[model samples]
Target chain A: MAETGQILNLRRYRQLRNAVVVWLTLVVLGAFLLRIPRIHILEHTARNLYFHVPMWFTLMAAALVSAYHSLRYLQSGDPIRDLRAREAARVGIFFGLLGLATGIVWARFTWYLGTSLWWNFDPKQSFVVIQLLIYGAYFVLRSAVEDPEKRGRVAAVYNLFAVVTMPFLLYVLPRQMESLHPGAEGSPAFSDITHPIMRLVFYPAVIGFIGLFWVLYTQRVRLALLEQRVEMLQATMLEAKS
Target chain B: MKTWLRGFWAIFEKDIKLELRARYAINMLLLFALGALVVMAFAVGPTPLSARVQAALLWTVLLFAAAVGLGRAFISEEERGTILLLQLNLRPGAVYAGKLLVNFVLLLALNIVAVGAFAVLLRVQVAWPGLLALTLLLGSVGLAGATTLLSALIARAAGGRGALLPVLLFPVLVPLLLSAVEATRSALLVAEGWATAADELLTLTGFGGAVITAAVLLFDYIWLD
Candidate 1:
């Protein structure tokens, strides 16, 4: 057991240490590329090309993970899958909020003044908020139940249901309704206006953000499993002492 | 075939009998629907009722009232521990079908009351009663399927209050709501023909069928847990 633990710890440290260096290098490169003065001619809105788009990519990745775990939980009836689903949900909520925040910031820079309300009742915005509220309620519902099996089952079911609605809320409704947000019909970048150079950074930004979300989700899942193990150990110790 | 139909009717009858004796769920729903319509009338005070606004008002009333009814439907069963008894006596499919039947009836009632209130208070005209009824039927099926599944989900959760119920339900109901609103708006518009609204109606029906199929398949899994 000791040898296995040492090996796992060494593996985690080695992988994560190298990953951090690579991530930092990319960040530095991205910053340098973004800082060139001529790039400002692309319009202040172009700043969103890096931040807002990546946040959306992260949101979609997290939601997909949540859905995957939900399906696993249903099929296996395992508490671990439920935990993964919950972690994915939490991470998805964070990215969803980040998307909203960054979109708002971009909106302020390009369209609205600083004094404008942070949230408008735009269909996409409303739908995303509704999605967040649903998952927020999922977490609240899980904590409220004391029985682990019931908590896992109910949260898994709710997560599945929420996942089913996300596409409609995020894509269908916005496309139907008139909206100020870009990309109702196609990619966010306009074909006519977007320089090929922008796509170079933009595509990588999406990939990097999705990668970051995966890392966070993995860490969260591990933390949740550890918490469960600790709780089980504590209960066992109490039983033995008694 | 006869046995299956009998089983479905028996489940439906059982729910109706229970509600009839208690008079809790239906009464509360009707009263809530009426009250919401009254409030909405006041809110929209003296403004000329455009067909779109009237359709929106009617939907708002029905949605909120159905939320109240849906939350109460399983909650009363849970509080009385009747769900376990019912589970032991009937198959999950039968129970689902019956609960859905009761919910369909309840929503239909609320829809009737909402339409009446809209006509009386807002002076909105319904151009095609047949088309409108068909639209409501399709919309109610979707509503009942989603509500039944959600009620079962929340019935097991902690703090499964009125708060958690709508929070869990509204997201799932968005497509239904959108389709229903579009169909209802089109039906109310004198200039727009039924052909124009056919796509929305079809979408609502498709969604309703999908939700019902999902609920039936998934209920057994949920029931065991």
Candidate 2:
């Protein structure tokens, strides 16, 4: 059995976890405290740029990381790779949900303020929700397969298929539609409108949230590995008793 | 190469023969599609829907109709215990290609019937009938390519056979669905040449190509296991 310490550097995990915590603290503080030129209707809600957009960035990062692990799992047939892939997707879904929720709240107050419409089917947000549903289906698939090895291979295959569709949902289709989201057909690209100063906080917020995702994903992977080890030990003990 | 083609044809012929005899999936597909079209027509009443709305309705029906029938491609094999027989006999790529062809043909027939019913009942005057046909053909290819592999995966899954297919499939098919609807809308609404819908056509073709290539590459992993 590979040592858990070898599989994951505990000391590095602790260090990164702490760093993410502190980094995110500064990010949140900067998000609210920083001054920027505000446009009509957006006003202070523009601060959501720090929070809402980063969730998507983190989700994308998590997805890529998960797909990479799934590909590795297929190549090597490593159980640990499956665990890592599943954990990354779970955490990615968490961030995606956060992104969706924050988007609804942000939209309700800004664009749809008087209409009180929480979701008017903004193309970008709707597509993000669909992407999240794809992730949900991945979990459903994982649950349906019984054998661990078969489950791993089957789920990995599905995950790869799902991931390949993500780019189309996130980028291509949304671009084809009229969207309130920046960088859509009529709207200016993010680089054009976003103040240069916001990038300092925005970029870090994205990195920080992805760092947070990494911390959460690694922690779950460690727990899953331990659980697998315990199950193996129990099986051995049962055979011995027989 | 010869053996691969032979394997593909054998599976295709057997499936076609079985389907012709049983008519299980074909009946389900045609009935569901026509049913949905009638329901849509009655629900809309005499109101004249714009081309875009009509396109959306058509694809929605076709999508659900596919959900109803396309899964039988692999689920029937699993149910009949022919999966083992197939696993023993053919290459995984051949199996995937054969099933994909079956699904494409099935979906194409359903689309034609549904679209025919939709135009007749709803009084739709398609400006570009050829483009409409082209769009439906391309749409069927992409839908079949995407769903065939999914059908295989879902058949191996233990539970939720009925529910899992669409849940796993609909999201992945969104791009194809979007392009199909757009192209169909143009075909029905505009008198312009195919150049107007060239972008959507390219997207549909690319999506179909990419999905089939990926399915061919990955079907081995699912099939052997």
Could you tally the backbone clashes for each prediction?
A: 0, 0
**Per-residue lDDT of B127 in model 1:** 82
Question: Which runs in model 2 stand beyond 4 Å of their true positions?
Answer: A1-3, A170-172, A237-242, B191-193
Report lDDT (Cα) of residue A55, candidate 1.
78
lDDT of 1: 0.75
Chain B alone vs. reference chain B, TM-score for every model: 0.93, 0.97
Least accurate stretch of 10 residues (summed lDDT) in model 1 chain A? Answer: A1-10
Top candidate on DockQ is: 2
RMSD of 2: 2.0
Candidate 2's displacement at residue A39, Å, is: 3.6
Error of 1 at B15 (Å): 1.4
Off by over 4 Å in 1: A1-17, A24-28, A31-42, A111-126, A179-193, B1-4
Candidate 1: give the clashing pairs. Answer: none
